[model samples]
Target: MKLIDLNPQGGIGANSIYLQIGDVNILIDSGLNPKQAGRLAMPDFSLIKDISLDLIIITHCHLDHIGSLPVIMRQHPNAKVVMTHSSKMILDRMLHNSANVMLRQKEENNIPDYPLFTHEEVDRCVPRFTGMEFLQPQKFKGKTDEVEIMMHHAGHVAGACAVELHHKDRHIFVTGDVLFENQRTLRGAQFPSGHFDTVIMETTRGTTERQVGKERVNEVSRLIASINDTINRGGSFLLPVFALGRMQEILSIIHDARKFGRLVKCPIYAAGMGMALADYFDEISRKYQHVQFNRNIIKELNIQPTARKLDAGKDLKQNALYIISSGMLVERTPSYTLASGLIGSDKNTIGFVGYCDPDTPGGQLLQAKQGEDFTFATANVTTKLQARVERFELSGHADREELAEFAIQTQARSVVLTHGDQAARDWFTKELESKMPGSKIIDPVPLKTYEL
Candidate 1:
């Protein structure tokens, strides 16, 4: 088997992999970078432009995983795209939202190459998508070779999956952004326990250790208590989240807390793509039984939409809980704007609940010491970071130790690492090498091809 990393910049953005097994050619995913603009954000399709792709597998609908699907589909018209059934249900909506965001960015940021794919293009790509069920093997034929593909539940989001492929006697497993611990809206990963010839896995949480009392259940309780503390003190709490899964899961957890009277009585405000996607989550919960989100959670919580225009560096002082998107607090996002306003005041609190890239504003804020001056360059606001900034261990990705254990158990002859920063991948490399001393661990450089 031969493989190439098509994500030119690597480090978790524009995630794409090109693999050739026998005569079959496959593209795992084609994502876009959240921080970069224009064509720079997408995977370098030029690397595979001349090769005719046989299959395109989608692990989930996260923007960082499927953001550039339309572009890739257009490039390889004959390729068949496959994902879990639940992902297919929500895939078009996610792509349409991406298109809208790109359109808005093109105007707001004055970028000439924005809106890389239009709504019509996404609509056309919808028909080419084929949804598969868990553990159901589907065979695809190339010019002279055939491979069987199956998906397993990967608990990071509603429709996330881990791919398993079989070609002759060689077996391959690809863990695409997985989480073993269950979340409120979704169950934990249900991976098969066995050996494979090759294993490819994500190293998202490689550098972070799960501290003793910071487990998911305790973290939920702590989050509720902190929200009550902030509201009682007449300050608002901001939770920047990823709209696809984290938003729905957090909403469900908050609802459970409020239902049991553990949460304080305070107005909850949520808006943007997350709220819009709630209906889809509800449908997926009912139709697919993969997710457990309900639209009624919003009604019961008396959720209100955030104001259309939030003034930078001016606190709203609503003393409410705000759950907004762009989890990394990317520039010009709703959370970014609101954070600028809230971070200046000692009364407010900003809590993060998911993974944040070290280069993003969220990661920068996490590393900043209290009383330091933080700048929101896009908002033109620079103020002392007086707000209480906290992080709860409620990330969607699996813990590094758990992931390492899973990789060790596979006992594959070769292990490939993807979807993490340099430090994170280095940690995985060391751990895997120490545990599986005889295995060939390859961290392929971007655009480089390696044979195994």
Candidate 2:
């Protein structure tokens, strides 16, 4: 069996991996950088074109994991798309929403390479998807023989899974963004203990030790308390979060805190796609009992519509506590506009709750030196909002120790790391090598293939 690494980070690429076993070819997680839209067109399948892909398995609905689905399906119309039922639903909604946003931005900014695929393409791709339940093994007979596929809960998102493939007496496990720490919206990843010939793992947060589990909850609570204190003094609190997992988790936690009287009963407004995702969370809460908020509690969580345009400064000024998305604030989303408008107002506090790419505008803001002022243009008016910016150690990925523990438990002969920056991957590789002296760790470069 051969595994190919398609995309890495730091312009290295994104998350796309190709696995070829004898006559069968399987592509896992076809992703693309949002900044490079046109480049996400169908990949050159010449290498595996002759060998028809038997299946395409998606780990989750995150754009970074399933963004290039339309392109891939357009290229290989016969390949079957496999994912969890919940993942498929979320993916359908996410792709449509993302396409709409891309088109709107293209039309407004006259940016080239807008939506790569039309809504019809997304529709075509949707029907091809086959939802598989977790832990249920599916048998796929290739032109040669049968290949066994097993899906395990990844716990990164609502329906994410880590795929295990068995063929020709070989066992390979693909870890697609596994989560070690449980959050308010999702449970920790489930591992199937067994010896494997090869294991593919994601190293998104390998370099740093994630905030200790117990400390993280405390930090979040403390940050909210601080914000509430400011709000009690007639101030507003702004929390910029990702519209997906992070937003839902934060809202659930806040709701619980308020219910227990840990925080004030101030108005909590959820903005942007966050509002929609929160509603979805409420709808699906019944199915995933491990999620932090129960159906009744999530039902009571308040959600406010996101600002429609870039200049909706007036809408932001009225809320006591607001949660907005486009987590990194790279795009001109409602969060960015509102944050720009309320920054300098001593009456407001801005908090960050997700990973931020340092090159993005939001990352710069997060790392801004003390006493720095930022100017924001809103509603044809320029306002300098100088508010305190703080970050909480709330991440969906596993920490160094957790990754080591997972690797130890897997007991795989060969370990491969993907989906992290060079430094992070290197650090993790070293750590794993020292801890597991008997196991071999390999960090694959883009397009680099390793055989097991």
Q: Best candidate, lDDT-wise?
A: 1
Off by over 4 Å in 2: 8-13, 40-51, 211-214, 288-302, 310-316, 373-385
TM-score of each: 0.99, 0.90
What is the RMSD, in Å, between candidate 2 and the native fold over all Cα?
2.9
- Model 2: residue 147 alpha-carbon error in angstroms: 2.0
The per-residue C-alpha lDDT of model 1 at residue 31 equals 93
Residues 271-344 of candidate 1 have per-residue lDDT tens digits of 77989889989998998766788899999999999999988888999999999997989998899999999998
**Tens digit of lDDT per residue, candidate 2, span 103-181?**
8867876768777778888887788989987888998867887778998888877878899999888888988887866
Backbone clashes for every candidate come to 0, 5
State the weakest 10-residue window (summed lDDT) of model 1. 285-294
The TM-score of predicted model 1 comes to 0.99
Q: What's the TM for model 2?
A: 0.90
